[model samples]
Target: MRRIFLVYALVLVLLSPAFSFAAGWRDGTYEGWSDAGPRSIQYAKVFIQDGEIAGVILREYTDRLVEKDWTCYDYPPFGEAARTLGTKFVEAQLAEIDAYTGATGSSTGWMQAVERALKKAGDAKKEKQYFDGTFLGRSEVADRGYYEVVWVTVENDKITGLQVQRVLADLSVLDPDTYEGFPLEMARQAYAQELIGRDNADVDAISGATGLMNMLNIAVRDALDRASTK
Candidate 1:
């Protein structure tokens, strides 16, 4: 009787959702990026082999379009958190893990980046395209020393609303309402109007505000990624 019970438990364990997910991964390397922020964006590269997480590579890109050196002691917390997160990911074989003390923000960013990478590595087909929620996306600092942030709301697979914010190199927020004639403001309105009710960020660029329009597209796409179910 005990032997039979052991066999039954083994069957149940094999059929568990977690076990199924563990067995359904595609063996390969996948990459994902965090939502861009004022200072930097985090990146994760996940290596999967035989349906298991083999390793993870973490990186950060600064506003100046350069990779951050984790070796720098000026921010010891970030460097330590970055290293520890990579190990925890492999050990747990999961993206969700406890945040490192003093580096909660970095930990959250790294986890999201890892989650995105693992999503790409999943072999199972997703039932839904996106999860219904409001997501924030920020653009990489542009050559002109400005960036844009967008709050996107998704419901029933369609975009319901968008709120746009532009930030200068000095991190000052621009008021679109008062800056009516500004090219960036004009571009923001044009793009936001075009994106409403759309499921994706494929929209036409504003002529004089091409650069800003590109930033808008990237920011919108980044938000959509966070909303993605797959």
Candidate 2:
């Protein structure tokens, strides 16, 4: 009887990780940097039920508060902003797997830390339901076809991922000089900040990238409409 009990205990111990995450939320922490310069933003995230990421919850530091004049009216949703910032930072760490479109800097920082946390916990998946938007080919330009191509990924009626690239090999269409050092990376970074956490199918077209942005708007609309039917 003692031998059987020991075997059973060993089996459970060996299979611990597989059964550990049945329904409980996973908690994690990481540090993020601000774009405004030398500001250190520390963040934490709790993975709630159904595996949805519960944004970030920022902690306030005495030094930070002391540096600025104490003004309540000017302060926006501080917690919400931290979560937003934290979400981007976590997303940044997963770049090699798939990167966000517009909010690159923040995304990179968050993702870098997230990747470490996830790796340590063995929680990384190739693809997650993070984005829910549909992919609508590329945006059309004049006679040259698509000046810049756009791809949208959405989840929960929100735009979650976006990718922009020159359409195939159609280099003749755009002026090489203007786009040369423009850093095509900004599109991904912008999509991250502006689209995530917002209602899908109604994403505001990005300021520039006219036609490409419009294409993304249409894709988001289509994705939400499809999600509604289901």
Candidate 3:
């Protein structure tokens, strides 16, 4: 009777789903908590078997910041959010995912954690694509070129990312000091948000930042032109 019971227990344990996850998780929900400022953010992260970060949604929040001085006060730190929210099963390089506008604090916080996880899983690699960082269109020495900085990234023959650094004539709009810590990072984010999952030449320009859009158009055109030449 004892031998039969032991055999039955072994069979049940071997058949359990948790045991299968010991090999690998097909999908997992990673929970993250952050303390960047006054509020604590809780994250519910979802990922695929390939190690690509599929998606993440904020599961809970405590002390959500209210906007007043152009910045969200008391937001969570990016690293904590990233660590708490990222999964452990990814195996390929990762693309930077979009963060919600106006929630820059939370977005960056979660991104930091996500990036760490991707690195640990060996899914993301560094590459100098068309849009790795900030780029300025230079035609003259006298020009500060702040009005038209374009950010773009390409992968797999597709423009995977974009951003306009400064569109507002008033520098204060992009200034952290004047804007109360919001770094006018919107131009790039706006561009990136629109370009992701899009695979065409005809991209809709941002209305509020038309000047920046014009500059980005020229930059993207240049990148595409270079690709064609190669």
Best by TM-score: 1
lDDT of 3 at 190: 74
- Indicate the residue-level lDDT of 32 in model 1: 73
- Sorted by TM-score (best first), the order is 1, 2, 3
TM-score-wise, the better of 1 and 3 is 1
Q: Count the backbone clashes (under 3 Å) in each candidate.
A: 0, 26, 13
Query: After aligning candidate 3 to the native by TM-score, how far in Å is the CA of 36 from where it should be?
Result: 32
Ranking 1 against 2 by lDDT, winner:
1
Between 2 and 3, whose TM-score is larger? 2
Compute each candidate's TM-score over C-alphas. Answer: 0.67, 0.30, 0.29
Give the Cα error of residue 129 in candidate 1, in Å.
3.6
Query: Roughly what TM-score does model 3 have, to 2 decimal places?
Result: 0.29
TM-score of 2: 0.30
lDDT of 3 by residue, 25-52 (tens): 2344443323223343333344544433
For model 1 the TM-score comes to: 0.67
Judging by lDDT against the true structure, name the best candidate: 1
RMSD in Å for all candidates: 4.7, 16.0, 13.3
Runs in model 2 lying further than 4 Å from the true structure: 1-137, 147-151, 169-178, 222-230
